[model samples]
Target: LQQFLNASKTIDEFPNIPESSKSLLKKYLTKDVYKKLKDAKDANGFTLQQLISSGLANPDSSIGVYAGSTDSYKVFAPLLNQIISDYHQYDVNSKHTSSWDISSYNFEEFNSKHKGDYVLSTRVRIARNLSKFPLGTNITKEQRQQIENLAIQAFNSFEGELKGTYYPLGKLTEQEKKQLKEDHFLFKEGDRFLKACGCERDWPDARGIFINPSKTFLVWVNEEDQFRIISMQNGGDLKQVFERLAKAHEIINKVAQFSITENLGAITTCPTNLGTGMRASVHVKLPLLSSDEKIFKQIASKHHLDIRGIDGEHSESKGGIFDVSNKRRLGYSEAQLALDMYNGVNELIEVEKQLK
Candidate 1:
């Protein structure tokens, strides 16, 4: 702990950190944890923290790193898309991303091989930004409202399974809101992490959820990003869950413009969510594996997966159950990200069975 804090005074150690981010870091991070960013680089002298500052401000920020747009991506996509491909830092051909091929994914084909009661519900979501607009931090309150109004209009235009009602957070009673959250249909309060990063600027003024009658298809307005289109259910039918989101996304895109580039499909506030912006996850009990943190890390690391609490990042697992999801999002297609997670979960479930 002392070593981490001591690193703050030695910013010279991180030559990759941009000057602007260095100044910003003074306000965002304490001396502690400075070492974590020491050698983390992306492009020409671009540190990871430059792309994700919320982690320094809020400890609860899951990976504590966001994938905001790099200077290169910002030139073309502007703040609309946050595309950073450290994977090919030296030679990134395009700052723009391709349009999403929603139909390319079908979770049934990639379902977990193991079948057990250990698995609970499954969810897949994508974060998208409205094109031609600044990010949440830089936008004004009026702009936020405009984005909200546009989203409502887009959602209302939906037909078939995509049809739903928008429930503004301010309009719902406390009890009603609690019920939705209990069912995992709504997001909880914005955490300190987001508050520090400027994502909580307008609060509930333009924020809410749009849920279809079945609640299987939903969209969060002005939450973590401009939109969080989701598909989820009580069990691990990844194919059905992903299919719903893809279909709904197709419908919404017709009426709305989501920031996209040749390299990044959807723009988002966080750099980690830059590429596909898909977070496909499941709730499952991992009693045996959880008991051994080292073993758990080994297994999860081997599969490119991450473990979070049922309530999400920085929270503790309860009743021996943990939330598991993919770690990589950028530089891959939506189908690839989901497929990787499905394969990784299968591996975890099989290993859990062996431990039992």
Candidate 2:
């Protein structure tokens, strides 16, 4: 209770919160709300402290909060629901249905069109958690290794294109680490946001990456979430990338159950990723379109797209290349979100062509 009071006091002082902080924790967490939820604890003994520790420690976190367990949703619905509705623009009363159907995603037009003029590479990835385990924030070291073992079994079960090797982070050689970082396939250690939330407790002990022979498909095990399945390749073949991801999603589901709900679609640690937990992106050159930040953002917003730097979020664009991706994750199907990026990128290219 005293800890809650101190944290609330700091939150009450607006000056203490950084001006650049846009997290929901900083936005919706008022003294009154904190006081109301202070003594509350979920059935699993997950406390409100565990939920907001990350946000409190990293004031600049965009979302600033996480779920220690799936039960955290029901236990902390008041704050979490508000954040979800605000970020995802989801109606709390409405149901969230997931659709991974790629049958109709046959983008014949895109297949024939030469997108190499502007598009460098296409990538699609989704965040998923195992239904039987607690999230990274609350998972024990033993549980984390167990998750890794399960992933190993799943990877071994793969036959055709999905067959791959698992490289544990703890065992990575200096050269291997450099190679992974250079290829942008590595998740670095010591993220302040992740650390504050207790996700970094076991460090790289049970963490690893599973990549197939082609290197186009990969999965990050025991990161912020249980799994971050991804598919990528050169050029702007969104359909191909998404199709691969969908197939992997299907295969993984056969090995383990993902934490999911009719109201949330895919349950994740962060509220912003609660629904689809998917991000379909392209690192493309949009020199003219991106020159004017305001116009670039306006056009992106019109198509429900988000623009990020070439090195990913918070980084700067390089050599006229920018990361363009779907902004909406909730209240939409997996295929719908992929289509949103496909159509949105096409629109962006058109706008770019018209620009000086």
Candidate 3:
């Protein structure tokens, strides 16, 4: 069973294996093993199907198929066990690096039906640090290796769990099967499969990639292209990655600000900052902070700048307060616009102090 599960890494590799089994096998095997299994052939010189039918139906075995007299369970259990074991191993090895904490890893599991088969799908999150590289620079050998390692590890862990389960028989009840059918797990002519990570979207055939249960905030990595999709849920990491990429690509920075009023006629309670709102923030490329305390306070008082600490006020109520990003205005670069916002505020405050 272990060998069978490990034989195919991709869905296309094992056509004879039920979709359910393929999904489970994917969950258990390491990326390396999964790739090998994907490329492996059955022992009998026949396909995986022929080998399974010959030996799986022994009566004394604990693993038996409920639907039919097949020994499907015996063929699948070892793969599942291997997958579970691999997960634990990863969990243990991953703990040593503060950067690779499980807290940064997010996952979701669900089931999908294709044709007459049921498939279990999962999404996992991974944290990658990219601050070391400057924008637009070619990836160094070290960086390339790091990215490859992450991709291989992720795929292996997924493959392990996938190999463990018997094909197409996820612990679903008869009622659940009926419900799933009603919910359209069965493949449709126009069904599409779409996956997005970070800012990239994959709509190969828009009609072919339908969302079974749509997921918004998850990371997906595709080894074929060596690209990833990062959801908004992990904005901190996403932002860092974006910044790094921008530097490497020589992309200019841009800034945009939100205001309470769109026009001068709009009335606001915050008298001092009525025109601009209580917040006056700029996204700067230099990564500078207000160092002169006296100047900072004077400006705050004059403009009614509610200088917020790292934990912004919106966080307490909305949860992801810090995730809100500055708007991007075209034409003007980010660094130039940020300088204008901060310097303009400082200039206004200085003028106000002089008049007083």
TM-score of each: 0.76, 0.92, 0.17
Cα lDDT, model 1, residue 47: 40
User: How high is the lDDT of residue 274 in model 2?
Assistant: 82
Residue 156's lDDT in candidate 1: 77
- The lDDT per prediction is 0.68, 0.82, 0.25
> Comparing 1 and 2 by lDDT, which wins?
2
Tell me the lDDT of candidate 1.
0.68
- lDDT-wise, the better of 1 and 3 is 1
**Full-model lDDT, candidate 2:** 0.82
Most lDDT-accurate candidate: 2
Candidate 2 per-residue lDDT, tens place, 1-356, comes to 34334323322232245667898888887776777677767655667777888887888788889897788888788788889999988996688878878677665334346333778889999999998888888787899999999999888888788888999998999789888876767776678788777788768899999999888999999998999999988877787788888889988889988998888888998887888899999887888887788888887887899888877767788988889999999999988998888888887777777774
Give a tens-digit lDDT track for model 3, residues 200-275.
1221111111111222222222211222222211111222332222231121111111111122111111111111
Worst 10 residues of 2 by lDDT: 6-15
Candidates 1 and 2, the one with greater TM-score: 2
Q: Is candidate 1 or candidate 3 better by TM-score?
A: 1
Query: Ranking by lDDT, best first?
Result: 2, 1, 3
* Stretch of 10 with least lDDT, candidate 3: 191-200
Among these predicted structures, which one has the highest TM-score?
2
**Cα miss at 1, model 2 (Å)?**
20
